[model samples]
Target: MQTKDHKVLVANRGEIAIRIVQACRKLGLAFTCVYTAEDAASGHVRIARELGGDKSLYRVSSYHDANELMAVADDAGATAVHPGYGFFAEDYRFARRVSQRDRKLIFIGPSWRVIRELGDKINTKRLARSLGVPTVPGSDRPIYDEMEAEKVAQSLFEFQEQQGIRKPLVLVKASAGGGGMGIEEVYDIDLFRSVYRRIRNYALRQFKDEGVLIEQRIRDFNHLEVQVVSDRSGRNPVHFGTRNCSIQSTGLQKRIEIAPGFDPSSIEYGFDAAQVLRDITQHSLAMARKVGYDNVGTWEWIVTRDGRPFLMEVNTRIQVENGVSATIARVRGQKGVDIIAEQIRIGLGEPLGYGQEDITFEGVGIEYRLIAEDPDNRFTPWVGRVDGFGWPERPWLAMHTHVPSDDPYDIPTEFDPNLALAIIWGKDLAEARERGVEFLDTLVLEGANNAGEPLRSNVRFLRDNTGRILKF
Candidate 1:
């Protein structure tokens, strides 16, 4: 199939939408984009108009409405749909609708079956265990009975004690819940039942499922992720590398991400950092190959202080931090690696064309998620108008944002206040940290809310965490 013959409907907004449109352009594929009324001033809409004319953009009531998206795709003659990161990116039902619709359109992530299979935490844990992959010490399946749940919780506490963990903790969470909902920490096993009951009740009411998962809560661990890519064949999959996402907000939301996971070249570690990266990547690939994973996805892992790594979950779509990994990756000894373009190509039924040995890593890369939030105050979202947003142009720096610099843009409260993503590359960790600090210090992002207060951003927060990057 000719790439030029296909058109993609960008079913998302903000920086990801802009990147997808850019990827489509790079791949010689036509594309259309959607925007809400609040997002009319977004840079994505402007880019679509400049590159694709009036027919390339459509207005929707909400990003969550699948019917509206389908209508827009049909009206715009889109042959495929690209759900960038959030929203419908991992939704199996949405993917199924796109594939099984009367006028079928391609779902540009993975097949619905693959998403459904891997989307479930229980199923993923079972599959990983079957493949001898390490997972958190907990129940592999949802525990519906209170006795079973308590037993699992007790075993987890005992297991932590046996491991010589100080102040051991257990986590009770709704198996069907995500995004930090229906979860509670039990520092004392005596209070476990109450917390468990509360979470179960909440889950039953909110998610309509009372099943709960009990696991040993591992604290002070370095959060790492393995980036994997494959074609539709699913027989051959290759990993880009690992990324360290330990720098995060109090809410556990990642603020900065560094590629290559750990850098023994610049930073010292208590464990074998290189071997740990290898273990996680090999385990991730093993599971992907077992399940025939067919597109770009991320395997989230938590590495304990003593070098123990456990699989957390899998993100079956392109993530916000993908560019950081790409920044340090080289395919066939060439730079300029674009993971989004690769995902689109494979999603369109094209072969991967390259093997794992063909890909290599270069230098350290850091990605700072610049957001309009007050990091000092629990990362509260600041609603305001961005009057000025600009940064210096450096050969080693790449910035991705939907906030336009030429005009004043309002910070929409309907979604996340992410302003831009600054990705920087250096010869090593020292240079990368220096350049990261410089970029944050010189960045010009000025704005004010409706009350006339000055713009408050996480720039200071990002700068303070520069010294702590990849330090596990």
Candidate 2:
């Protein structure tokens, strides 16, 4: 068990830090927040510290400065390090260095080995198959070269033919990509060849590697995820329900998200996805135990028309929308961060009040990711200071934002060096929807609208359907 005096350096920025800080406070640990100069005034920095973090760092660049981050953690006298989502959360090398430092840097999630395994889309699928878990119909290995890709494509066609499909729509996917990046769909062999060739170069630049996966494309499919928590002890592996993520816009220039989705019951099969969720959790835990995994994490899946759930990927850290799931589970009084605290306690050989089954979900919760983007101009990313922001007296509303009054309202462009994210949660699907709409209505952005089209579209969609748009 960790002593209450544990000082943890949060090696991340933004709303995720805010969430982690809450857990640390509840567990009675001294938490610190780190940020680049750009994020110095973010809400994450404001909420966690009794006096805010004494130590903050700056790098030459705004994002992905791994070495500088590790150095800051070392300098902070921190007993553990919590890498909130993004940044180096899944970077094996960072975790290895932290572990080697012998400062008891708690990863707050999976081990480097499991991360290494899962980060490789090729190997992850192999592991899934070995565990008798269903994976998307795709190449078992990352395509190495154009020739190899062609060979795999040919074999895929043969397999499709055997399945009575003369032609199959396929997606050329970048193995190391996430958050809907590095994915392309091609309906025919010719299109696949042309798009595959183009995406290969893009993947090389984005992932700094050359490996892609060829998989069948599932159109009009609901993107759902099962949030689960497991410990190093290999006991009480459990599923924490699902989140629907099907309301994304059609193009890159435009970006929007909805929750609860279009029709939750129409996608009732998503509930049946628990088995797949269990398999993913079990497999992920087994992999973690084999490599010493712990803390809270999530397993991502996509349910197809045939009512089969296919493994997509695994997130080694708490997800952005985790608050929503936690709120829903809170109906049974399971606060999201409480799960992490319990898991951390268990991982550290501490005690817990109850078993996993003791936790049950109650009403629905909607979490809308409010970003600094313009809803006009095809949803180009824009950033600026919040001229005014307020939440009206509304039911079931919990707001999280990063902007501070003292900060400048500098307008941001698509390539703005800094960005802000806000998440609002509500109770029950209906209540959550009402709260989200009411909250957005009260949100006012000044300075710039770089991605206005997408932002407006998203707000309008949420206003129209609450969070149910995500239930697709």
Candidate 3:
């Protein structure tokens, strides 16, 4: 049973909010959703209303309106707040402020301290080393100016010499940035200087942090991430296997998302990717025990051609790929969403409805982000109305759209107004890939700006790079 006061205000928009609201309803708790003035009629809002939510909804100007969102949470009698992935997911200050209110404002992931410590690229590398996690070799501290960056670059070169490593490429990253932004791979000194200047400007504009971090880049790398869930006791944290994120730059802002990319035949019967996944999961859970990790998070890593895994960063929240992961689990008679709801219920001192083992992984899933952006136009944000959207018969697919049906968004006559997504699951990876492509083709986006070509490019990019694993 939930506690007497179990109201939850999801401080996010789009499919993320819808997913969380569903969890809230399953727990018999009052659920509230907030939206932007533009997205007031979004699918998230519609789902909340259909699920018996009230008009006490709050509206913000944009996704970054942190203060306004908090006010809405407060006004909605929300005892806990869940900030879904993206937006303020990694904002330590926002988490701290929400907790300061002491109204049981659950950040729903790692503690504010963990976010504050790991959100910085330099500090993250240091933490990885302390945890005995293999990390890319680079500067041990942040490089603030051009002179400092050059000095660090030289030292990195010297270190590579001592280690007998060749062609030591470096990645310049912002101290406070994620989402594949504010990061550039530099192959040489001149390139480092050029990319550093450009990346610094972008980082400054986005995060106001000019401090850059440099790290040796691994070649022929596969981006793999382990999802982790921990409790407040911090005694037992668990890893949820791994996902192959090697589908680099599938256009339209989709950086690459293909999970369980390993061939089943190659994986030994019992001791294969599943074993490594179990170990990683155990390690993550143990780390949470030491640091008091809460809710669900992910550990990102880069697997080099030689099979060495280097820890990259930790995401302390439900990821965009959560729906995909859950869809796959459901096919195997597992309930991933129920597991999440149970986690929240346990945290709130309510009776846990299910155990961890109840949600087991099965099959393969693909999550493709469909946005209304013009890839030819530098992936610029396209805003307007979604005139129409439908899906062909596909049992293993789930669609999440932010647009309202009847009250179509008014497209600006220059861009597609549909920022939606299609998550596909299959008994295995091959079938999932085929269905994903078909789903993208069947996506009938009607708008003034021709977003079809860019979308096609994204689908083709994924289809072409399916078997060839390489870094972006």
Candidate 4:
């Protein structure tokens, strides 16, 4: 009911901010955006005003500062705030501040307490295990000292030996860390203490949390996840099947596709695809409902060699790979499940627009992250102007980008610009792969480097790894 009358504030940067702007227009709502000084000339900022953002309050780029963003919303008379999947999307303090009455703004996300609970790896893992959801074998509590770290390391080594794994690889993770930070992988048991100390120090510096835990690292694992949407009315959660996100060098996701991946060679795990589609998704939704999860979120999992699935973590906001959800919705004969819009509605005290039985997925969607980084040069940031930009001509291709030739922004080596995205939809994984690769070949980002080489890219890497990344 509050869908059209509210003026929403898009609080974040890059593609996600631009995405919220588009959603606002589709819903007949006015919106505002906040960006950083570095993103002053980005497309998201320039186009937001044209889309719906109030031009007067749209120029400022101080995105990470919660107090500043809330103030911006107040000045613009925004009725709600949409923190687009980064910066403070999972920050409880920021959510709490937005929920304040003087602000009178609806925080378009999970409740602050839910964010707080999900932010803690220990608490989330505990919750999952309590709900009978399987999780990776690891320490039951935080490793408070070096002795505990040693004990955990030896236990993992024994597990590796039992499983015939050559190395007992383990990951030390911080309770509050995200984006692959606050984590250290230990290959040798002898080096456990030092690595633990290093991770503890890094966690203290970054997340300010001294809590750390270790889990057995499955070398041959498939990274899968379920997208779940919950409304504030306590309705049963709606789920959009699972996604195959196993292709990765580190934790940085390079490509993602809808269920039923193409080319079995690309997927690394040993699982029955059809059964997993039902089990993992139901497992995720059941676990979330057991805990009364009250907003749209992602439930991540890792599948082992034996086809066993385990809970990894929950992301309490929209993910960059959400295009798969959109494409799947289209296939299921359901419309208006735009996750961001539903998030707003839930915050505004409305029920989810559709029930689980109302939707059915029918196709495959592929999303490839396009960043301005030199893969050959240790993945360093390539900062320069877009000499030439090109893309495929098709109705199903979705490109979310922020770069512009008129007034371009530099890609900093210290941060992840994640400037562009390519999301394509198809009837199946094979067609999606073919179209994806063909479309990728047409993408030409030139004139950035001094050597005149095309924007030191990764399009080829994605094409080459298609069949190589599927579950076995």
TM-scores, all candidates, are 0.93, 0.81, 0.84, 0.90
Candidate with more favorable, higher TM-score: 2 or 3:
3
What would the per-residue lDDT of candidate 2 be over residues 1-472, giving only the tens digit for each residue? Answer: 3457677777776656776677777777776666656555566656754444455333324447756656666677677777777778888887777777655576665667767777666777777777777777778767878888877776776667777765567778786666656777776676667788778888888778778888776665666666666665545455556666655544321122333222343335545544544544555555444434455666666766555667777777776666656555642454553555554455444533355567676555565555554444544455444554444544455555555545554433322322333344544455555656667787664443444432222455445555345443
Q: How far off is model 3, as Cα RMSD? A: 4.2
lDDT of each: 0.92, 0.59, 0.65, 0.73
Clashes of each: 0, 28, 6, 11
Relative to the true structure, candidate 4 reaches a TM of 0.90
Consecutive 10-residue window with the lowest summed lDDT within model 4: 260-269
Could you tell me which 10 consecutive residues in candidate 3 have the lowest summed lDDT? Answer: 449-458
Residue pairs with colliding backbones in model 3 are 234-289, 237-285, 239-281, 385-409, 385-410, 385-411
lDDT tens per residue, model 3, 250-349: 2213444655534444343322544444545555555556566666777777766555567767777778765655565542364444435645565565
Which is the leading candidate under TM-score?
A: 1
> Which parts of model 1 are misplaced by more than 4 Å?
139-155, 172-184, 189-214
How much does candidate 3 score in TM-score? 0.84
Give the Cα-based TM-score of candidate 2 against the true structure: 0.81
Q: Distance from true position, residue 284, model 2, in Å?
A: 7.6
- For model 1, what is the error of residue 22's alpha carbon versus the real structure, in angstroms, after optimal superposition? 0.5
The alpha-carbon deviation from the true structure for residue 451 of candidate 4, after best TM-score superposition, in angstroms, is 8.0
CA RMSD of each candidate after superposition: 2.5, 4.3, 4.2, 3.0
Off by over 4 Å in 3: 1-4, 48-52, 102-104, 120-124, 139-142, 158-167, 250-256, 264-279, 330-343, 346-359, 373-386, 405-407, 410-418, 450-457, 466-472
